[model samples]
Target: MNDKKLELECLRLISDGSGIGYINGIATFVTGLLPGETGVVAVYEAKKKWQRARLQSIIKSSPERIIPPCTVFSGCGGCQLQHMTYEETLIWKQRWVEDALSRIGKLKVTVKPTIGMEHPWRYRNKARLHRESTGKLGYFKERSKTLIHFEDCLLISERMNRWIRLTEEFLTKGYPEIHTLTFRENDKGEGLLLLEGVPTKALSEEENPDLFEALSREGLRSVWGSDSEGNLVLIWGEEMFNQTILDMPFDVSPLSFLQVNSKQTDVLYAHVLAEAALTRAETVWDLYSGIGTLTLALAREAKKVTGIEENPYAVEDAIQNAAKNNAIGHVEFLKGKVESRMMKIEEQPDVVVLDPPRAGMHPEVVKRLLELKPQRIIYVSCDPGTLGRDLRLLSQGGYRVESVQPVDMFPWTQHVETVVCLNRKHS
Candidate 1:
């Protein structure tokens, strides 16, 4: 019933952080309700089979429940599991992966406990914030366009928070054209700013030399503005900045994809390398390789590693990174779609590594992988739903899932990064 207040017990959390409870054989999803907790909820939308509700009051809270450190944690869309203890979140993350594998993939496999951070807060190396008409920079409320401003965000470093405040103050003066601002940082505390809008007279370094100089002086090594036409204009400093992953230096542009949590990235990549167990005899193929981070890492032990990526800027960076790392000899980069470029590849890989996007690998890419039958396949996935779907297809194609390792790459969020290793089953 729409707008009906009812008491219900939360059974479990769904993929999107909503607690699911059954009411008369129908499912009721409520936000802010944790598992093992009973709460009164106001059902806003009711369907024949399911309903959506908002938690009104918690009759009983879970033992894992804790006060979120961030003042705007409840309203901000940046984090989902802040109310729960970090340990409980890790357990739930592992279960999420296991549930996906069992339900979606129909493959029973052991999922290791989620690898988590010692200090999860302030781990993110990137922040993309929305700017309101009033020049307030913050994230939107969960599932709403209503922007919520905060003095600080727990996920990003304090320096980044200052940068956001500075940028917001600048925008407050004038520059409604700039609607979005992205700030990226490296381990070295170097920052990069991306302003998504047309450069205005106020934004020009020639006119506002002090503003640009101030940003540069405040640890911003590079600043860029991109318009609707996808044209990037350098506002200040160098075009490329540096980031080190696993003791390897990478030239990262504002556009390149990088794992946000620098500490957990090290843990994730180290686990992938251990699972790969390369012995310098096998040829490796890194699909959907962005800037050759993993590809170059694989090259250290594999006979040869080829990276296939679509973004031209990322490919250029990967080429330069390979050269800079002295991995050029064993690593080669191909700029194209993985599904299409894989067809033209002449070398048959002994080991295949895939780090696809949230949408997962293309069907054609999965089909070709089955046809090629690489002896071992290691998949790094961000979305468990898609990972399970593709894993089912690969399982049916004569591959056996060897192991699943879930890593808490995005702390305080429902997102979990997983690394799966599968082997070709022999007849």
Candidate 2:
């Protein structure tokens, strides 16, 4: 009857199952909306084809709604499901994976309950903070180029939070522009912030003598260089403090691609090992094995393990890690693309563990793997869309999906890491 009531009906949430709000045939994703709940959405921008709306008022709240722990839950864009209860979040995520597989991949495999973290909050061991000219340090807004500043992040480790506070103080000293700051947590829980950038004209040696001293006080390591051509030189500290390096446990470099969540990585690795079902006489191939995390694990079970990676630094680190762990004799590192280098292997592995990037495996890589036809293929994917596509191709080559388990390596976000076990039809 009134203008406000008329606007409410225009945006009806047909299904709020996957954090997506369907309004007038267009999917409008909102944070707090739940299924069967009614809300007044404010339309900010409208086009002839579709409309975008924000929740104005919750006329009815779903039972799934819960109190958000973080004060900046909505604005931070760090955690997507913080508003929803943890139990509800897990249920929805499982359903999301099942729906994606059935609808997108056309597969009928069972989707197991999501493997949740014991401690969900502050699980991230790494945080990449972007710096703007305005002294604001935080993540970029979703779909926007602007940055949203924050003092502390609930998702980062406690040591990283301390570093963020100290870095904020350092930035207030009228230093030059800093493009990005990557924070890493060692096994000892010590935090290191790698500040990357060239010394702009605004930054002078005499102006900020406290930069290095402050970093030392905060126990933060500094690495200076342009984004394109600069080495990660450890200033004021050793290269690694806790985790293994080359073959011994040590700290990883800022440029290295270690798992963001340190605690859950052990669990994820165990799952991959179980899926592989390695034997002592069989060889194993770890594809895209960064820093030999999976390669080292595989060597413990298999007779021998060969890891292939494109990055020479990662391959070198993997070699060092293997030697340090006393697994070097059983493991070897090859630096190259998997599709091209896999052909050089004289013996086919009994198991192949694929942990590709978010883009998933290339078509040629998939073709080669299917041709090799290993006894078991363990696909660890970060993106469900590409994972599903690749799974379909593997299925075409007679590899049946045996089991699919979703691991919540990253909590609060829509991103899910899944490990699928596939076996050859005849094997």
Candidate 3:
């Protein structure tokens, strides 16, 4: 233990696996280890508290280890389980949610098997690439500022991969210093790329005419401007082709908080709606409603739906989307935090749908929901840790979890989305 550079062999990957190895009695996170594999990890930094290490070499390889499909697998920090087998990856993700609920939520409940994607690869409908000063476009390194240049990303759709290649060609042809690129795929399979950068003094509309022309040739719908104030403005497009609809139609702006996986979002929304079981007489309240996706969906079945959101822009967009869908009469937009605004509502809803952020519901908000005491509650969560914690609190206040279903929103990733339906326990 007193050795300056101790070499420890990594045996297997544990639950908190991110390819980070562990040194016995050192408690340091080291990378480059697979389950049942043996690798010598060199401990460089150590304290009376803990130790850190880097993998020197792989002494033995695990049978479960497979060659990563992405060339930039280790360099690009976008994916952690690229080296893991698909079946193993799914098992670990399901265990992660179950463990979070048992340890964090401290409740006894059944966590059903995860619903995985049919084709795990090419499931990502959107991707964000960082452009460095050297004109290299890729993802950032793990826990570092270094950019790992990549020609193709395995997680995104094939169309997005093509767009990256096309953008790289554009950059080589005297395009300005681009900072970031956001790709979004519509339901029709067309893509829109939003480029952000500071324009050079000599650059002009005439000089960039060919850039738009090239984008059009590649079948890209449009290209937007990352303006001086860091705002996204439309530079060129058909205007009509610039829109994207999730559950409702919204003028897809660069800053809007749309779901990254477009295909999975449709599935996610459908599951959420089914769990809510909205009826003609039921009035539903949707908390943390972003752009009225779930609100609009629920409005179709319920008599009325009131959506609460914090972002002013998103609330405005939600109202516009409601009007666009002709559901304005059925859905009302309330702009504010759930805890504060719930107290002032004139009427209590029959059912409440809570889809809070990763941090989960505020304790006060949970308490207020119990006070309001809706007949049923459907909780949709991206973070299992927070969801489990909130479920424990809800269970104590006369709510019993009817069912919990896990959805694979992010394929080939550790993230899992769960929808929990809770009904008031009858006497």
Candidate 4:
């Protein structure tokens, strides 16, 4: 009930970048505070066990604290750890994985140091932003619909930033139908620009010429416009571009999943591949395979790799990618949820590799994995919370954690991508 300000020394950071502090034997989490810092806290929300507070002022701060470079750092939800030095950010991520395993997973497995980028800035190859009705391109403010229009973002690649400028200019010239814009560029300089417009509103026939002419100047490999239903109805150049990973070319579409940090993706996948330890005679099952990125990689080393994905679009791209990589004979793509399609396969795989989404694998999928009892299970996870929960279940089902490697895919954000390797217990 007290909104009165009280000074507290922050002890550590929680998952969402809030610092934990103790006041009157009760823990309170305050935003924008770092460990070893004394800050004046004002409680905004109080719960039974802890309270959420706002850092009013910092009387003392950590040595790692630094002024964020981005002009919209405080308001934009795009990046969270920009306030700290890049080195400190990596440290925070490593601690997060360790804490999640201990607290959430209730496991004592050792977590390795996080693999970070040597040059972390401007690494993002994909960006999703909102186009306001006022004809502005910007990101939504933190926890709010308010738009924070930025002239430049340090996280996006140089090509994406240029496209954003051209987009703003194009809108200023009178195109306000687009509600959301998602842009992606490959290392080869080819890019995909997707415009999502109001579903019910029909596009005026007269607007095509002017808009297409203006957009063509940006030199994107493809420009796709979709109705509110998200079905592509407009195409400029091509719908897909080629991206090379580990010297293997992939057909990357705007609809397909590609890691935003291309360089770190190779690093992360290399770790995953190493952890898989394929003997060239093991059958690999890649669950939630997107465009066969990992599936194709595993196909090169495994006897046969079967990929199960729900997105038919991505499956189409994955099939194409395998042919392009000349691994078609070793890999097959199936379009369906892993939980459902996995039950259809009669043969058991020697090794299973799954790169699940943030929510982690479905419970049914985990239950099935236990029934199949693959010798090795390599889980590529983006969210540690879900990874921890899943790990606990798998461990209880007789899987022993071998090692965990955390990769810093997003440098300035609180997000951490991890690869956990587990081996089934022997009788």
Best by TM-score: 1
Residues 1-427, candidate 2, lDDT per residue (tens digit)?
1233212332222222233455666655544567666777765656566555666778877777788887776676667777777776776677777876787788999989989987788888788888777566788766676687776687886667877776767776555556787777765566665667643333333556676566556665443333445455444445554463223373355666888877678778888888887768888889998888878878878899899998766877777777778886779999998878887888887889999998889888888887788889999988777888888889888899999998888887777788999999984
Which portions of model 1 show Cα errors greater than 4 Å? 199-202
lDDT, candidate 3, at 350: 88
TM-score of each: 0.97, 0.89, 0.87, 0.95
* Candidate order (lDDT): 1, 4, 3, 2
Give the range where candidate 1 is weakest over 10 consecutive residues by summed lDDT.
198-207
Candidate order, TM-score descending? 1, 4, 2, 3
* Best candidate (score: lDDT): 1
Candidate 1, residue 49: how far the Cα is off, in Å: 0.9
lDDT of 1 by residue, 24-95 (tens): 888999877899999999888888999888899999999989998999887886798999999999999999
TM-score of 3: 0.87
The better candidate by lDDT, 1 or 3, is 1
Q: Please write out the lDDT profile of model 3 over residues 1-427, one tens digit for every residue.
A: 4335545555444344544444555566566576566666767677776666766777787777778899988776667777778777777677777887889888778888777777787777677788765566777787787888877787876777777876766676554467778777666666777776643323333667775576666677766666566565666664433334454565555555667776777778888888888768898999998778788888889999999988775787788778888896879999888788877887888899988999999888898888988999999998888998999999999899888888887765667888889999886
* Candidates 2 and 4 compared by lDDT, better number: 4
Candidate 4: tens digits of C-alpha lDDT, residues 28-59: 99878888999988988888888888888999
Clashing pairs in 1: none
Give the whole-model CA lDDT for all candidates, comma-separated: 0.90, 0.73, 0.75, 0.86
The worst-scoring run of ten residues by lDDT in candidate 4 lies at 198-207
